[model samples]
Target: MTLLTYRTQARWAVAVVNSKKATAEFYDVETNKRIPRTAWTADMKAFAAEKAANVPKPPFVFRLTIIGWIVVALLAAGFGVMTYETLKPTEQSAEQVAMEQTPVVGDMYFGRFEGAAEPDSLVAISDLGFGWFKIVKVEGDTYFVAKSTDMSKQHQPKEQLESAEFEEEGTPAKIVEQTGWQLTLEAIDESVTFYVTDKK
Candidate 1:
């Protein structure tokens, strides 16, 4: 025994079929009314086959619409990622870090040593201050740099000295040696170098 119930509002049809018997029935929409039994004999099978032949196949519109929506959604997602990458800033890289780690060095040298023929030289540069100086002169082969807190405005090699004028009255200033401090940074020019000595 087989029965089918059609609910017009729901646009649904439920069928109960007896696969072995090949028997079926159709029902009305309201009042649970029984319509009639449909026998699956030779004639009925032939008629159903003819009806199926006349009925058109499912249209391509529904499948195409689903595919089009999926494509659009994927494109939207890709575009969102690209927009985020363009609008958002990138993080600093190790190379950038390395560059930033370098500092701008400033230096100067002066005075003389026991073995050196010329007055010794002291050179120092730092990112902390803007300053300039030069080597007034050199007579010997070797040179050493020193630092001083108070350098004369007109002093040629205006180095911040560790020790004052040599005992010889022309020995010049000298360095503090191991006491030298340093700094590092990255400049706009993309160069990374360090100031070998910095004032505390």
Candidate 2:
């Protein structure tokens, strides 16, 4: 007996025959599994023909998949950077902090007077003698402080201190110049701590 094999338009179907009796068996080529003849419909035959003719090759599909993953990874990294920037704490430089704490023009300093009628009185730097004063100008390490009319009230006169009418036009009564180390020493020697109330 001789065996014979034949191919069909379904592409996946195979026909086998023997001299004694002819018999045929169909298979799904993609899965290499047996398919019953009854299950091989016209729609399945058309889909198989379309797939074989129109589908992209495996290598191109694999490349597209790789590119998609790369795009996704890049997006994730970008989002991570943005999230870190948004959530990270903002830090101020030492120079910025010092600049903010240092006195500027139109700034008012308040200190407590020991034996005065009111304990909290607007006073100049302790070494400059006890009197109301405001910073008129700043030049390098020098602070030109000018004497102002006395404000011996218990509460800080923030409104009056910031008012334009409060400014005086004349030579500065005192010029306090100090290095960083000297300022630190002055801070230590001062009996009352001076704090800035208003900043221009």
Candidate 3:
């Protein structure tokens, strides 16, 4: 009796054979099955050859010289510094920080005045109609707001309203000055339904 080995795509297989009879009992390691010779295919020979060609070589042995070690250390240090810089918090400009914390001069607040009439018109504030107030001037805790023209039945105003040049069209009919305390009070007032700020 003789023992022989071959490989398939799945795993290595072994055969116990009677040398004189040229007959063998084949066993597949992966499937744990006894493979019949009639079931073998031409692909098996190709798989075995491929498995032999692709046998994993021993792990590569590396011997770093002093210069190589120094280069690797420098690269590691550079990578660490890059990672820290990527993760660190970035500082915001003074203007940017102020804009995020509080409303800026160009910011506009859009809302409807429940019972108030439109400027120079008898039309009362309606559900379909809305108005906005622009922050025309700001002086230490006091925001001077200029009321926009009663935007008709349209709730959405044009994009031009966002520009500072829009304020130059005509003199504002009413300018309401309010401190932070008064502004907070307005938020709870029943007359003023909603005030949405648009910051530039």
Best by lDDT: 3
lDDT of 2 by residue, 43-84 (tens): 655555554444333322122245566777899999999999
lDDT of 1 by residue, 1-200 (tens): 22442222211123222222222333456656655435356665565456545544433212324556677789999999999999998786553443333221222323221222223445232213222222222334212222234433332332444333322212222222322232222222322121233221
TM-score of 2: 0.26
**Which candidate order results from sorting by TM-score in descending order?**
3, 2, 1
The candidate, 2 or 3, that scores higher on TM-score is 3
lDDT accuracy of residue 23 in candidate 1:
26
Candidate 1: where is the Cα deviation over 4 Å? 1-39, 57-96, 99-200
Off by over 4 Å in 3: 10-128, 136-146, 156-200
TM-score of 3: 0.29
Clashing pairs in 3: none
Cand. 1 Cα-lDDT: 0.35
Error of 2 at 69 (Å): 24
Q: List runs of model 2 lying over 4 Å from the truth.
A: 1-87, 90-133, 160-193
